[model samples]
Target: MENGSRISGDRRPQVGVAVFLLKSSSILLGRRLSSVGYGTFALPGGRLEFGESFEECARREVKEETGMDVVRVEILTVVNMVALDGPDPTHFVTIIARAEMADSGQSPANMEPDKCAGWAWYEWAQLPQPLFGPLEDLLKGGFNPFAASRLM
Candidate 1:
């Protein structure tokens, strides 16, 4: 524990992808069960694997967590998280991206019951809380996941 700047043993910062899986004007939010962001509503995402691209990670995480196939994934923003509030100062570089469901017939079903309650869509202004750190930072930084007219 580096006291909120970086993880204790790992010197390299963690890189991850958070998806804004959209349906028309609404976006998907999942309740987190991880220790860092327990009980918070945030986008479905996780660490970037060794050889995968950002879009790949987004699609994989979305499908693995929410059981929904996402298509047309695109990068929306890059978030630099420097956590300095707890016993361990952790730093994470998160790639915020967007995508739409590959099939209208498909719906979200929680795949990782241990990590998520379920996934639901919400208007950007009506998103649930308490927000995850990267999500809160993205919101405070004026990042908006809406505006996907194509989804509509």
Candidate 2:
């Protein structure tokens, strides 16, 4: 309910879109500054707006968060996370997408300093420590963005 959504009676889970922006042998990640996952590394993405297609959400979020355009946007996987132990008792349906930079030479900028510390390209095999919950779940579920991208 951090986004102002009613938490008292709303049992519906929120939908989030996470993009794995692959470039050469690395993927884009940013250190989150949000309350839910502060200091955790996560992909460039946000809540899936109403009436928005998955691809649209992917492209829009990447642009909004990183100030970089993405291409070949495609859904790679989905994750269902239910954290009932916390006071908020939140649930999230995360859609994971894969994409490439519109311009390989274009570097990412910290578009939302309040939400993320900074952005960096990290190799898949050696991601940063303390990954976002959804991202950790994705990895545990064996969803490899690099392998998925090659198949697509």
**Highest TM-score model number:** 2
Clashes of each: 7, 0
TM-score, every prediction: 0.87, 0.89
Candidate 2 on 1-152: residue-level lDDT in tens?
56664456759889999999888788899999988888999999989998999889999999999999988888877889987655667788988888878998999999999999999999988999999998998898888887874322
Stretches of model 1 off by over 4 angstroms after superposition: 1-10, 148-152
Where does candidate 2 clash, by residue pair?
none
Which pairs of residues have clashing backbones in candidate 1? 3-88, 3-89, 4-88, 4-89, 4-90, 5-89, 6-89
Clashes of 2: 0
Candidate 2: misplaced stretches above 4 Å?
A: 1-8, 149-152
lDDT of each: 0.83, 0.88
lDDT of 1 by residue, 35-143 (tens): 7888999899999999999989999999999888989998877889887677766678998888878997888898998988878988876778798988898788776
Cα deviation of 9, candidate 2, in Å: 2.0
Give the Å error, residue 9, model 1.
Answer: 4.6
